[model samples]
Target: MTIHLAVDDSVAVLTLEHGRGNTLDTATCRELVLKLEEAADGAKAAVLTGSGDMFSAGVDLLSIDAGGAAYVREFLPALSDALLAVFGFPHPLVAAVNGHAIAGGMVLAAGCDHRVAAAGPGRVGVTELLVGVPFPLAATEILRCAYGTNPLAALMYSGATLTIDDALARGLVDEVAAPEEVLGRARELAARLGELPAEAFAHTKAQLRQPYHERIAENRASDDVHVDRMWRSAESLANVKSYVDRVLKR
Candidate 1:
């Protein structure tokens, strides 16, 4: 299954479970969007967690290697759809990040109303560079919208995975808990948020989240260019993979 869900009174817990690392595949993305919509429609608050030992490995590398151009062409809007849906959800959304959470995985966690990470070396960042891919238009603005200007540059250039503490310091993550306690902590946050006045909470949330949405909308309204597809000699996925493999190995 792409996702797993459990309901507890006013709270809904969602899990990303799609392989060894919970990488966001096309199928997984679609499943998550549908599941989150279901959760948002009924639950007072929702908490999303990753399956197994990872928050997410980011995107499915094999998918990209097999269908890079088509994937990028379609991925922007699919991602935006999911993010906007979460940002506009009627109920509070919480992310109980367990580990890694790089690239698109980072996007998933950040889109939530609240973010909590398991305390460890598990990091947060947009690590597409390490995979020889680009964040595309919507994803970039989404990151900028959440973390603002300062955090954007660090994520883009450094591309270094920030520890959970660093993630909190950078305003990328909201709370930290022990690995085993992540779900419980997220449930607690969900329960607390559920107690707030839903009307006021939603209004305030709308006010806060729209800027990012607006930014993403603006970026997507036009066509932007990138070099990820260059060197196609024509382009060979193997060539790109070699570059990524070498970079990550370093």
Candidate 2:
């Protein structure tokens, strides 16, 4: 399984463990949705983190290059579904960003109610433009909600990865901790938030997020069409290939 769930003191910890980087692919995304659903059913709160030294390297770009346009068609929707599931999860959710969270990975972190990142070399940023893909509506909305439009616009446009300090300054993460303390800090926050009355917390969360949900609902159909088309285009595919080559060379 790409995601492993462990529950303690009514807090569910969902660890992304697909590979060295815990990259997100169609299957991984679907599994994340399922795991979050399971957490919601049984746990008062959830903490998301990644295995090894990375939160997530982001979308499985190598997989995308190999899968081609046909796969892109299937992957985009699943990605959106996964993002929505994380963003709309009723209970408290925290992110323990133990390492790098790039591109879609950063979006997932932003979707959480609160994010705590580890100190050290770990970097965070939105990099869809660098990967030659547009942000899915769900991703754009989530980041916009987390960082506001001005900062979000700058991050998206530059596709620049930021250090843990820069991330905190820009509001990408709420707290910073030592690498080893990241998960503990996240769990502490999750458990603390979980102690609140469930109904009240859920209600307040819904109210805060309601506008974004409505915005997504109204524009997703059209926005996704454009996003999917861009992702599947020959130019974008070529760009993905170049990116993969560059990374492989380094």
Candidate 3:
């Protein structure tokens, strides 16, 4: 499975494991949503981390190249569901950014309450425009919540990938831990959050996120329609194919 779940005491840890990049395809996205649901039900708080040098490279472009628009139609909604599940999770969620988190990967981290990065060369950013696609509605809401309008626009427009220190300076990540200690730090924080009164935590979190949640709900359907159209367009497919080829050649 792309998502591996483990619970110890009150903290559930979900690790993303799908090849080196942990690319989020339709199956992986569905598995992520299911794992988050399980984590919420059984654990008071959760920590999400990646298993290798890359947190996630975002959507599986290789899959897109092979499957074409039909895959995009299926993958987009699954991506939205996985992200919304994390954003609206009842318990506090901490992101242990083990490595590069690009595009949807950044969105996943932004969905969490806290984001901690491992100290090293790992980069983080929203790269949708780099891939010549628009952000899904849920991802846009998460970005708006994580960054101010100007910074958000700059990051998306530039497709800038910041190092851990730069990500911290820009508030993309809360703390930087030694590479080996990243998961530990996230778990420690999750344990602390898990200690709070469950009802109060849930209610307050709901209130704080209600606006973003509502905005996503309101725009999701329409946004998906437009995004799907873009994916199905010949220009988008050609760009995606070209991107995939470049990456493969590297």
Query: Per-residue CA lDDT of candidate 2, range 1-250, in tens?
Result: 8999999999999999976779999999999999999999999999999998899988998889999999999999999999999999999999999999999899889999999999999999988898788989998899888889987888899999999999998788998999989999999999999999999999999999998999999999999999989999999999999998998436
lDDT of 3 at 190: 97
lDDT score for residue 194 of model 2: 96
Tens digits of per-residue lDDT for model 1, 79-176: 55665665667788888998889887887887787898999889888876654456656667667767887868778777788888988997899889
Q: For residues 47-103, what per-residue lDDT tens digits would candidate 3 score against the true structure? A: 998887778888888888999988888888998999999898999899999999998
* C-alpha TM-scores of all predictions: 0.87, 0.98, 0.98
lDDT of 1 at 148: 80
Q: Cα RMSD (Å) between model 2 and the true structure?
A: 0.9
TM-score of 2: 0.98
> What is the Å distance of residue 33 in model 3 from its true position?
0.9
lDDT of 2 at 67: 99
Top candidate, metric lDDT:
2
